[model samples]
Target: MVVATRELPASGYALEVDGRFKAEFATRDGARAGAEELKKRFPMLQVRIYDALTRAREDVQLPRA
Candidate 1:
């Protein structure tokens, strides 16, 4: 499993798996722990996790602008 994370301006963190939906955390430590837990639970999923803020920024906007 591959876990990734990014820090938010509000002193929190965002986490995700396999480039899917994200989970917000109160702190980076919490995010790391969450990612590790996910890996342990889904060891065979080939997880690719990342933070929400950066990912959201990169994602396409809705409503076609």
Candidate 2:
């Protein structure tokens, strides 16, 4: 599983996982908050964050449960 954020000019950011839209955030902080939520929801999977603007992708580091 992977989570990503796409920037929206008017709305802020859009969160997605596996090519599906999961949520919309009003700011970068909100998107990061969404990422944390995703980590909590899927601890066993390899979650990641991708920045559409930078074209960079990295795996999400989940805290030990």
All candidates: CA RMSD in angstroms? 11.4, 5.5
lDDT score, residue 38, model 2?
Answer: 79
lDDT of 1 by residue, 1-65 (tens): 12333433333455545555456666556766766676677665433333344543222212322
Q: Candidate 1 has what TM-score?
A: 0.50
lDDT of 1 at 31: 62
* Model 2 per-residue lDDT tens digits across residues 21-65: 455555566667777787788766554444555644455576665
Task: Give the clashing pairs for model 2.
Answer: none
Scored against the true structure, residue 10 in model 1 reaches a CA lDDT of 38
How accurate locally, in lDDT, is each candidate? Answer: 0.48, 0.55
After superposing candidate 2, which stretches have Cα over 4 Å from the reference?
A: 1-10, 44-59, 63-65
